[model samples]
Target: MDLTSNRQSWAVVGGGILGMTLALRLREQGKEVTLIEAARDIGGLASAWKIGNSVWDRYYHVTLMSDLHVRNILNDLELEDDMRWVETKTGFYTKGRLLSMSNSIEFLRFPPLNLVEKVRLGATIFYASKLKDWKKLESIGVCEWLTKLSGRSVFEKIWKPLLRAKLGENYQHASAAFIWSIIARMYAARRSGLKKEMFGYLPGGYRRFLQAFEKRLVDAGVTIQKGTCVQHVKRTGSVVKMDTADGFEREFDHIVFTTPAPAVSKACPGLQPREHGLLNGIRYQGIICPSLLLKKPLAGYYVTNITDDVPFTAVIDMTALIKPEEVNGNYLVYLPKYVDATDEAAFSRSDDDLKAEFWPALKRIHPHLTDDDLITFQVARARNVLALSTLNYSESLPPVHTSIPGVHVVNSAMICNGTLNVNETIQLAENAAVDFLKLDSRVAADVAGSRCAQAV
Candidate 1:
């Protein structure tokens, strides 16, 4: 095979937004791109599925006004102009009651904290937003940092429970940067030219956006292999070989593995020991988010943060952002619980078992919601969702370029700074593509030059 062609063949081994975007970018660079996904579709975390009669995202995702990368892609797909932006309210479930903490008045009256505690809590958020030194925050544990800023009362009464809800017992291992990133994004939402926290979404959720995106990719001359799993990867001379589970092999000039770190480690056995250790060292927080198709809305707030004991961390009322008419006039709610990725028992629990525990807790929060009000229930579990921002997380992250020539690993584990959302995911892919492609091109040029010199 000639290694001097201007057009290089690239394989993106993951159909998530990361891989899709990478393939599109590479194709735009005049490279022949092939996207392979193990799932039936290519959206990965942003993928949509049918729940009852409605087709919606497998996990709950909302677009923030600050999400520039996401908006850019939507613009390319001609869906940005059609985005529906809404000012949604926030709720806090605490002290056995649901309270509206969306505004100043509601927040002042919140019963979970007294005036002093509320002031301290507010100060903590304000302080965190103004702090720009995120790397320094990584040195301190989340508990110590929050308690220092908010005091013991505010930390115990509010922050601790919220931390446990999101991070589970893993909160103890997290750094103050974890909380800072969350606060920074929430603050950015209000600062994103809207001057208020405005969440936007397409009319048909991700289904419409993805269909358009898929068409755009296909039109751009990118090959998509859906339901095809890459079992192993090896480097052979100037080309990278990918072996599928079906015993199919394909060689590409370069290949990028956008799958999870563990998956990458298993697929490519030739990685250096240090690189393998770094990849395996990264910890991820999994989510078991269940979508509830309800007859009526459960609290009008888009997001209801919980400080009380509940089976789920938060209640995301999709109907708040999306009109009820969208899903057949039925409300859609997402109850997500972030668990340790290694917790097999939690992931292995049957749907019926979860229903038994989840519904009763939800009823406790809203007694009016009963079995009759429930239209249908569906669970979406991902063992690796967001990479946990541990102490000095970025310092240990494996580089996108692996030890093997022309084989790179780029996944959610590389997203160390921001929350794992569509925007951050897109940004990571765009940035990684630039760096990796430059290196890839240089390597190809070197190989071509050496071959020409040898022949001469």
Candidate 2:
């Protein structure tokens, strides 16, 4: 396929990581690329917001060392110094008090699971980590798989709540293969030091990541057009017919969609099969994450899980986690709630109304956090921010390539296996680029995904 036009242009829709990374990779190969985004900014859902002088994410974001793709990017961007590895805390709340939930030894001590249940659970994880092709496991439900393999107690105590939070009512039907991939993440991130389980974040927010990629894009000669919405598209033979929201019609030799799956299907309906229900079969709950700047740190731990709470499954006081001092004693909290598909009103709620409702619900978790303790608040809503990976979800996700050759799709909805964190985002972006470049043979290797395993 000849990607060269008279102007030698290639249009990349979506300015997020997948879009930016692919654009830069293509331009580095000496292709003229134009990047378009509807938002005023470039980071997509991955962008950061500022509260006074402190920068925080719309939702709490962190990466594991097992993220081979992210490791490679950080080194290439030379952001090693700008990064920090913190061994954070993970806990479960039952009837209120937080339990120390970290590592294998502590996992066994977890009151929620008995010694026998814990032993079986541990063995299951070890077995999963060594797995090569979990494709066959997709046939069974996750709940069924765990109950049969581990037992009823372990599945009820551990797997059920997590699946409920992650997949809503469809947990019972979730694929065993998908559940295994999720379990392997824990096995990969363990360590024995102060934090055998550690995470990476730039001293600042993810804006640093955006900046690094933007710099690389500029250096590679990619044209980045911000606040530009793509109004329409028409594919004519090898070249795609295009029309912008700004009322301009143009053409490109190739187009790669890094936008959300919903938007892509909406924009180019003809290219996708009506039966490919990977994303469409799944339903995503919108997030109403409100962050508050506080006068003090709410908790000592950087990360905490609120499995039992009102209006929210978890409340991440990012200020406390990243160190409140970094934000000048002002704490930032995230109040994220899952919403329905038809509930447009939830997404359109005002910030003030959100704060009024969010604060009291927050007080349920921390009673001492009075109204006076609240500093400032910001409400962020990313509609379809998380794809509902319900039971039997693995079969829904499609391969990188589609019937349309020059077109590619990548996003959070496409996290078919493993944790869909930033590290996975980077790896997915790199892998997509290889597909776009038709370089699959170059990176294929037999690496098991154990402890950040990257098997080709």
Candidate 3:
């Protein structure tokens, strides 16, 4: 699908799905695209690695029926037809007991809240789903908004604990838009016939999709530079120059930085002080996710939300949604702990030390479990997994078009109205690609006009 008319070179300095999308989009616009990644392969957070005899996603991921952007990407990769969809249930660990909260009946029967509290909680979700002015939510604190809608008891017994799990103490700084975005997405799924709560996944997970996507990029004549760390990026004259840590330098007509805000700030020192400040203003939440391959399933529910004190945030039983045969008849579970990226204590604790804290909680949740059921245990850590949706987040975000002539910054921090997910990421890339091409055209026209004026 080469649309080459007047080819211009582009350098995308990140190989995640967002970067891959940008490269592919640029190439379709008749641009020579080069994707450079610091890691050995693409799929930054979505990458998979060996876990004993099987390979699966390092972090837990699921495709909701409402995630049209993700489905579109799968369609482009020709993997949409092979997707497997399954209905799964949800569980809640509260008040020293494990309970089912999947359907309206279970939710009404939930022991943590009385009848009135249950009604308020349900009403809160329904109201949030109908909200259209999410920007107004950014001005209000999450705690205040939830407390007002769900009442004090429901906020304390239910909402507070869940917020603490996902955002830690940083929930204090979050806006109402944060929770609204989440409810909107879930309701959107319900609108798509997921009232049964259906989730989908590819057979081989993202690894197979990434392999196919990489091959497609290659077929489209896009250059892939893997395992290359970009040290510095600057614009000189009409083009942007990038210096790699491996003693390699390359120049392109324009550069699009798809890295995190901090990394982009470090790589491009030529940006304005305001741009640097905006980049530094963004905060991120990190995750320490441990994948446990067990001989038997812990709970049949797909996701178990915990309100009780636990080392990890939630329990994700992958086998509940995916077939056990996918992982050689072994059940895969993810115990994820979300912490502030600056939390040195949580990040510094070793694998063995974490296991010491986590194993006890696992047994506490499932009292009948024993050590022999565990086949393998692996942990995955990331420093800046998702940007925090702080109050007025979008207002403080660095724009895609920077002060530098041929440089642009596009990252997850720019995701204002949506939660951090692959779907939102792909949509961001699509919008950024359009903006980039328009900026490129304007810059090129300006350069040509200047040359004509000089000749006259």
In terms of TM-score, which candidate is strongest? 3
Q: By the lDDT metric, which is better: model 2 or model 3?
A: 3
Instruction: Kindly report which residue stretches of model 2 are placed more than 4 angstroms away from their true locations once superposed.
Output: 1-8, 193-195, 272-279, 339-349, 390-405, 439-456
TM-score between model 1 and native: 0.95
Residue ranges of candidate 3 with Cα displaced over 4 Å: 191-194, 447-456
Per-model clash counts, in order, read 0, 12, 0
Q: Encode model 3's per-residue lDDT on 1-456: one tens digit a residue.
A: 547674889999999989998898888888989999999989999999887689988888899988898899899889999999887899899877889888777887888888999999999999999999999999899999999999999999999999999999999999999999999987776633325687899999889889999999999889999999999999988899999999889999888999999999999899999999999889999999988888888778889999999989999999998889878899899999999998999888887888878877887988877898878777899988889888887799998878887788898888899998999999999998888778768878999999999999
Location of the lowest summed lDDT over 10 successive residues in candidate 1: 188-197
Give the alpha carbon lDDT tens digit for every residue of 1-456 in model 2.
333422335788899877887787777655688888888889887898787577766567766778777777777888866777777677666556677776656776788777898889888877878886766676777787788878988777666766666555646555786677776786677674433567777766778878887888877678888887876665688777767777756688677777766677666665657424543566665667777887756655555565564566566656544656667757777766656544688778899988878788767667777888887888777766656555556656655555565555666667767655666666677776666555323222222234236333
lDDT of 1 by residue, 1-456 (tens): 222344889899999989989888878777888999999888999999988798888998899998999999999998999999999899899889898887767778888788999999988998998999888988889999999999998999899999999999999999999999899899888743324468999999998988999999999889999989998899998899999987778999888999999889888889999988988888888999888899977878899999888899999999999988878889999999999999999999988888889988888988898789988888999988878888988898888777898888889787766778889889988988788668766878899999999999
lDDT for every model?
0.88, 0.69, 0.89
* Minimal lDDT window, size 10, model 2: 440-449
Report RMSD for candidate 3.
1.6
Give the poorly placed runs of model 1, Cα more than 4 Å off: 1-5, 191-196, 444-456
Best by lDDT: 3
The TM-scores of all predictions, comma-separated, are: 0.95, 0.85, 0.97
